[model samples]
Target: MTQEFGSQSTTDEVLAGVNLHGKRVLVTGTSAGLGVETARALAAHSAHVLGTARDLAKARQATSSVLEAAKAGGGSFELAELDLASLASVRACADRLLAAGEGFDMVIANAGVMAAPFGHTQDGFETQFGTNHLGHFTFINRIAPLLSAGGRLVNLSSAGHRFADVDLDDPNFAQTPYDPWVAYGRSKTANILFAVEFDRRHRDRGVRATAVHPGGIRTELSRHMSQADEEALISTINATNAAAGLPPFTYKSIPQGAATSVWAAVVADGDAVGGHYCEDCHVAAVQDGEGLRGGVRPYALDAERAKALWVLSERLVGEQF
Candidate 1:
């Protein structure tokens, strides 16, 4: 069936009449917001969902609604512990999944940290770059062997990638001054590049990867932002929109915010969407301006840059994938 869902499409709407009876899907950061909504919507279509959280108890509590939805849809739900800030925790999670020997139809790299004060991960990389990019990079690569043929990998990138491109020479900001938003942007850009290279390497094996920009939503991911930061962000957004001749910024409801992600994960054609950055349920155009509402930047999807970032990432993480 040919489907034409869009930015306003709800998760349930996208999956309406679709059957995922035996599909195995893994979604990270299920404790709240988009992750919870994404998992619930998939489960509501009878997909077996494995949702992760840094705190299992909180995840179980947060995903109670998901369990209820699963019950209603005759789906199943399970939980796993994951802390994206620690490579050790990432390895443990991958190890557990490996031991299960069960392959997934889809894997969604949905968990992340937003703009925060300068800090380092347990492995000593910049907090945002390490947790949002390298952490998922390591985990997904380790679990790549467990993806079923034709499986989909969805990395949740952001429109914030326009803030900065990946810095291959100093990804951790050891030499340069640390700027929270810039670091976050670089990490998000890495998310897109990771998907780009991943598609190139794995598409021949029937696996496809894509990055998604879930529209702006008032989620916990913004907990670190102070009032001043919020104001500055709004100003930047407005200026960018004005320059682009677009409307002022608007936020999506949690369900609405998750639409594109669910679309990329389950509804969109893998080959058509693979290696691209998507927003509003379609492959986004390349817009160069910073703080623009709805498109990816050219650098984010460059194949050569993707390859270079992959090599640099492997070296930084000290693991050859």
Candidate 2:
């Protein structure tokens, strides 16, 4: 029987009775929070996991549990240095993987920053935009040849994307005022759009790409936010939920946050999620709204916009996919 999963499903629960003895998966941001949990769960299921982090030292210490799980479950776990804020680092990491030549069944772009202060990446693009979107864009495209024919690419996006759409004209916010939330939203939207176009480009080769919202989880992604900032965001969301006669907003557990990613990568039918946006372990409806209840925005999945963003991204990164 096909199992039913929901907002609170844990990684172990999602993988119940499913054996992944030889599947190879690449997950970014294994240093903490959802990334660590994601790697651990996959490793627990005997999936060979290649995890990346900006700081190998910190990721090694944080993912000691992943190593243990891998050992116990007859899987393997390895880590590599990847600083998404630096295109140099991203290319170097991709080059190393390409040189290794082992194919991956899935590439989970799960690393990201949220609501960070105004700044630029090593490439001079806005911090969130460059790190979250362009970095992965270049990194993943660079390693496209290594994606197994039936492989899937899952980008970790968020409901925070509701805050804004991509400003193709001024992605760097040179003339306009900068709001951390807006910048994050643009980056998250880019993640979904990137997945959309990527799926279109690679589906003929049996590779698919999709983006997912992991829901609200108290993870290191929120490190940039102050207590007041977090509380205020919660208050705003809860107020909207209350007005809509919905349950008060609550944060998902780290495992819950990681579940949808694994579900999209391995369990969900590839055709169902390809070029789509998901949340709560299912393909979310395209809903236009002010509240973060649980649906994708129309703009986030626009094909034309996805194509436009893809072109823009290539130009910015000085590479062609």
lDDT of 2 by residue, 55-163 (tens): 9999999999999999999899999999999999999999999999999999999999999999999999999999999999999999999999999999999998888
- Against the true structure, whose lDDT is highest? 2
Candidate 2: where is the Cα deviation over 4 Å? none
Poorest 10 consecutive residues by lDDT, candidate 1: 286-295
Error of 1 at 92 (Å): 0.9
Give the alpha-carbon lDDT of every model: 0.92, 0.95
Give every collision pair in model 1: none
| Regions of candidate 1 where Cα sits further than 4 Å from its true position | none
For residues 1-321, could you state the per-residue lDDT of candidate 1 as single tens digits? 287877777887878888999999999999999999999998988999999999899888899999999999989999999999999999999999999899999999999999989999999999999999999999999999999999999999998898899999999998999999899999999999999999999999899999999988999999999889888888888888888888888788888888888888888999889999999888898877556577889999999999999999899889998
Model 1 residue-pair collision total = 0
